[model samples]
Target: MSKVYYTPWRNDLEMVDKFNKILRKSNFLDNIEKDDRIAIKLHIGEYKNFAHVHPLYIKGLVSALLEKDCEPFLTDTTTYYCGHRFSAVGMLKNAFYHGFSFANIGAPFIVADGLGDDKGFSVKVRSPLNELFVPNLFREVDKMIVFSHCKGHGLTGFGGSIKNVAMGCVTKKSKLDMHKVVKFCYNDALCDGCDACKDVCDREIPLMENGKRNLSLEKREDCMHCPACMEACSRGAIKLEELEKIAQVLPLAVEGIYKVLGKENVRSINWGANIVEYCDCMPFPGRTIGKNTGIYLSDDIVAADKAFLDDVNKSTFMIDGRPDPEIQTIEGEKIGIGKMDYERVIL
Candidate 1:
């Protein structure tokens, strides 16, 4: 069983202190050595969203890493979603605005997948996500630290460490690939070939064949599963059932990330405060899903997320539309990312 370190929610001052204490006690940073180029993977939330993992905790993490004489940089990939974070230029501006700059967090904020997505390389993993397009940034980093906010997720119930890596580690194409596992469903009967789906799609995914709307295999690769065709159809034609596959394929994505960045070279930290019904990628978190919990730090991503999942479920339960929280843990254990069976040591 893997080990997970824990501490209850405390006030701001003690919170940062306990963050450092927990790291020291757990000895999680001992592996990070002098001159190691480390990538601090974080999701600096999009556009005016204040509920992302607090900057104070992130600053503390940077300070701790620097003390060890390792090279650390705050990094995250651009979103597939079009917004302030769609491109590297916009993402940097927003991250700096959110207080993740070198001045505030003591590290430069770098967008892992720059403008073209050409900088990344691919790595093979288990089935479901046989290959993942990860940013080339992993090619240089010696170690990684994943700092994720524990909260409700539409696909994986509550996203902690697992969701962060699966969706957050890879490039734009891989992000869409995870969602596309549940391919586009089409009903030839309902499709009128009205060009409604065609007109709406920016990717030009819909096709006209035999006077019926079709999801052409050639063009389908680029499908964002945005479900624009499904929404635009006045008729009951196109269906992209459950586009978010974070629960089923998340572990594979995590395993893929591990394959590139060796499992031993990374540590996962889930900040359990600001628990909410949606992920940070959203415009805004609506409300607290449960009482604020503390932090879960571990060498094992699966173990860390599992501890966070257990608490949030008992306190507030999954939201109406979310998936079973155990799915990610079960799958992660199945794929050997880390076992669900873990010992939680209170810090």
Candidate 2:
């Protein structure tokens, strides 16, 4: 019996106005306590990937939180991959540069994991459930207000609030462990013997074979398995063997996040415009595959995400320029996490 609020609008929309309407109608402001340190969880888009939730929208959210005397801070953990937000220093710099400054969004940025990347704690959810994911920073937060930029991912189909928390709240180590699928592999057909993998390998072990650099894991147990070499490989020759395992990790990680959040302290808001078919973590911006719908508010992460998918399908700019809702879930129903069956009240 969860209530989800829908506020549909076009790209030509005023974020501040939408914010006030949504906060008021959804009674989100009513749930806050004065001076509570609220972690406004959100994705600060990777460099050159600009389809993230708007900073202006963040400003409006911050303003609403301030009205209730809630102390809000924009926060997200560093990614495992090497990128603008891969480390605390780099992440903070990227946050500020992306207009997430206290002066701009009316909230300070906080990296959930510590400077050295060891500030996170782990929590186990669904004692007997098969899924086992551990969140680094989710357990440390007092409260969380998730703001998501709805989009599709090449790997997980759709990226929404659940995906945001599953990936966003964890540490790099957790991400790596969860995403680890297979060992490194190189295609001789594509490899021009550039030895880029060898150059990036921390252990300096992978050697060239048959005119191609084949990853040698003789001391594979000693390797940090950062996969930097795999990413750096040109011609897409080097790859990890475990796509299914990496995909399996996202859902398990989500279950862990839910166990930590424990339902009460979490609220989700999704900004549904610029629905790109890829994650914002990419270094390059991708094309928008759908039209801008307004905001959706719900405590049910699954339902709100489903609502977002439905809106995108119904958007005028869809693939066929018609409604075609088909979003494959990363995992099956998030049963105890939240209900997919929701009452959507249009605002």
Candidate 3:
């Protein structure tokens, strides 16, 4: 079994010290070599969500990396939806807005996909998506530290280290491809003509016709696959299909791990603090679902995510009345990435 190091979050000790101790206990820094350009892959949170992994913890990681004479840079990819982080310029602004400035974290911040979301290289994987477009800069890094915030998600059940690597490292086109399985349709019988879907849709794909909403194939083609429309429908007029297919996307993340840093050269960390019901991509804050479960670190992405989901499942929180987050780990194990079973080592 793989080893997963964990440290409970305590109010007494400084967070920086707690984070550094976890890193050291996990031997995350020991894997780095002198002068290695380490990519600290992370989601810097959306415009207004404060639930993202605190920048202070990242500062601690950067300090630890620097002590080994290694170079570390904080990076994330642009989003497919129209939001603060949809473009490189907007993403940097949003990062700074969320207090991820170089002055704050002691490391440079870069949008892995370039200015216009056009910079990327492709990698082939054995999945419905035979190939994925990874960020060009992410491919060039010698090593990577996947720093993710554990939280609930509408589509994938939960987001953690595995979700971070699969979606966060890839370009927008690849992200859309993975999300293609999430197709939506309108239930005219349940429609109350609220136009709630139109109000929340970023693509303005939902159209009102004959006192009900209709989404054309051409309009749905531009859908970002976000759950805004599904969630906004009070009467349950909108229906979604193929949610289980989200598990198929895990191979992209598994392939990304091998293509980018290789399994041995990467360390995965999940911040279980401020566990929210929705992903950080939301423009608004979400309700806290699970209580703080602390942090988890492991070289095995599958094990780390499985352990994290196990903790989340222990809580009363449920996404769509079900704990659907384990699919990624189950699918990951089937793809020969890592094991679902692990030995937990608390520090």
Question: lDDT winner among the candidates?
Answer: 1
Per-structure clash totals for the candidates: 1, 0, 0
Off by over 4 Å in 2: 125-140, 182-186, 189-210, 218-245, 313-335
Error of 3 at 117 (Å): 2.0
Ten contiguous residues minimizing lDDT sum, candidate 1: 313-322
Q: Write the per-residue lDDT of candidate 2 for residues 1-347, one digit (tens) a residue.
A: 77778888844456558667788777765678998888899998997677888798889889888888878998988877666787889989888878788889878898887773664665554322234434455566667889998886544456788778777877766666655443556677888888777887656767888887765657665454454566678688766654434444454566677667666788889888778766788765467778777788887776777677766653422321211223223242543566666788888
Q: Looking at model 2, report the run of 10 residues with the lowest lDDT sum.
A: 319-328
The alpha-carbon lDDT assigned to residue 180 of candidate 2 equals 48
The digit string of per-residue lDDT tens for model 1 on 1-347 reads: 88889998887678888998887777789898899999989989878887789888888888888899999999889988667898889998889888888888888987888773644788987777788999988888899999999887654566788888888889988888787776567888888789998987767778888888766788766777764567578896876555335578988998898988899988999998888777788767767878778998999998998888767654354554346777888988987889888998998
Cα shift from native, residue 207, model 1 (Å) = 13
Output the worst ten-in-a-row residue range by lDDT, candidate 3: 314-323
lDDT of each: 0.82, 0.70, 0.81
lDDT of 3 at 188: 86
Best by TM-score: 3
- Model 3 whole-model lDDT (C-alpha atoms): 0.81
Quote the positional error of residue 299 for candidate 3 in Å: 0.7
